[model samples]
Target: MRNLKTVYLFELSSLLKKKAYIVTTVIICVLILVVTTLPTLQSIMGGENTGEEGAFQEGTFGIYNESDEITLTHLGEKLPGVTLLPYESEEALKEAVLEEEVSSGYILKSSTDYVSVVNNVAMYSGGDYLMDSALRLVNEDLALQEGGHDVEAIRSIMSGITITQEEPIVLGKDVQNNYWVVYILIMLTFMMIMFYGNNVATYVAREKSDRTMEILITSSDSNSLIIGKVLASGTAGIIQALFMGVTLFAGYRLNYRNYDEEILDFLNMNVDPMLLLVYFIFAFTGYFLFLFVYASIGALMTKVEDVPSATTLVTMFVMAAYFIAMFSLGLSNESIILKIASYFPFTSFMVMFVRYAITSVSLFTVAISYGILILTAVFTAFASVKIYRFGTLNYGNTGSVVKLIKTALKDDNGR
Candidate 1:
């Protein structure tokens, strides 16, 4: 216990004193703050807000209607709230787009054909699709007129039957509302684990390569060394992550009302406090478990260059857990696969919390899942100490993690 405390405090203090760690944490928090406040800044600068429902209101388009059959009034009616400037020729329409006089231009060849001109295509540009829909409506009207049919009468007939919900349908939860929240959290967890987990492995490998491990192991027991290292590294990572989360939440609150209404669905910052607490718990435990494995992997490497290769299997497992959680997001809480994953320690760290956040979950179920994860983490930490002890001194050709574990067990039994 004394040795564990000394190691934990020393490792933690060493990590805190590093310029790279402190600077990286500050930079990330600053970025989160700046990104969250961007909407407010844009609004203050008088930038145009283009939302889905009001997209047409934000830009102007040029039109050269060569087809006398298609009137400006009909086109205007099709695209409500859009400004259409008429051009004398197709060349003029194209020139208007090139000169930035309009967002885009259209030259009507006939009721069925038209040419669109734009200076550049945007990632989310749907102006051409909107124009196509409007042109299609105009062509249909022109065809109906040629057939001697009343266009308004046909429109009224089509618009007569509309469906309306008599009452609001209630469900256990709304997946769409909570999806981005879980997605962001999952990504945050994955990155922290991958980055800080590697930090642990690399640190151990560096110590081994420098002959520091030979001196340290003689002074301290392997159990104390591994436990203290994992605890200290996990604490540092959690501190950085928590600070960033606080920065994001603070920025969101400071600029809450400045955000576009449509964007509120995905950027909704009204997360439940209880859910956040549960996420922290799972994330902390999962991080601690992974770091111990990382530390053992680090002990197995004789050279610093082998760190990446040694950690690849653990990285793959973390990625698999990430993908599994993402895939299961849209599934029902009672899904057979989700039910199994929520209890399985390897996946429960993400799956269980996701279930609790987006849907209804019992306290008993959460307790059971958490208990399993805690036990697994405890067991992994003890087992990793054995591997760490064997591998740190063995410094020879350490095969895979599986083979190392088996050999470590045999060596321990021989003792």
Candidate 2:
């Protein structure tokens, strides 16, 4: 463990000075800031009001009335925030629609029938729905008028009978509010482990390729070298993550009022602090565990070009963990697979946090999961040092992982 701090500082300083790392971090921070500020920018640019009364006013539509039975004025009134332009003929309405002067056109054949036309339909085309709704109300109005009933009086009475539900007293987590947060955090953990894990592996491979590992081994123990390098990469990753996280928080806070109530509810700020703590514990522990394993894999190869092939096994394991955690989302809380995954070291990092966030989990379960993760991390770190020490001396023989481990143990026993 001698010179552990020196090795850590040297590797950290090297990472901090890399131009690619600095630029990537800055670009991600700026992107997060811009994205989080978009709602505010939209409001300032005279975007349509998202308030309830103003929500329906989206676009203009052309209407050609072939039937003299229905009133265009009353139909327009029924669809608020929508501008209705009347045309003299169906051809004129179609021309307006083709020229993009209106979103779409409606040809009213009679009180009960109409033909809708548009140049091209997009995913959210709603012109047909609007026309149908307006015509239904107009037909009802026409019927009431023919019966000598006051249509406006009846409409007012119906509109006044609004039914609203009281917010329910729930004893469960709000999945709608927590889904995005959990999804984002899970992705963050995956990306960090992948990016930084490969970085540590490549660093180890490069050192071995250039005989730097031989020189370092003479000056320091294998434990210090491997632990220092992994910690350095982890520290750099933590710095970049913190920058992005703080920027996201600050930007969201500045634009809080610009978002609608539904949005506010979905991305609520009332997250349980304990959930975040659990995430960090599992995320960092799992990160270091994988990095140590990647470093050992790096030692199994002499050429830097072999790093990708060497680390593929560990990468697959990480990907499996990510996929399983994502698949667990929205599944029933009684899932036996998820419960087992919460204690399994490899998959627990992402799955346990997700379970804690969306389901009712006991504190004892959380502690047990943590205990398993920490113990596994320690074992992996020590095992990685042993493999790295033996691999450094036994170069040019990138044998199978199982064979390499067996040989390392045989050499250790002979010593």
Best by TM-score: 2
Q: List candidate 1 stretches off by more than 4 Å.
A: 50-53, 136-167, 264-278, 332-340, 356-365, 413-415
How much is the lDDT of residue 35 in candidate 1? 91
Taking all chains together, each candidate's TM-score versus the true structure is 0.86, 0.89
Cα lDDT tens digits for candidate 1, 39-64: 88888888746556666456888999
What CA root-mean-square deviation does each model show from the true structure? 3.4, 2.9
**313-348: candidate 2 lDDT, tens digit per residue:** 788889978987888777646478888888899889
Candidate 2 Cα lDDT to native: 0.86
- Name the regions of candidate 2 deviating beyond 4 angstroms: 48-56, 65-69, 88-94, 107-129, 139-150, 253-267, 402-415
Query: Distance (Å) between predicted and true CA of 113, model 2?
Result: 5.2
How well does model 1 score by local distance difference test?
A: 0.84
Candidate 1 has a TM-score of 0.86
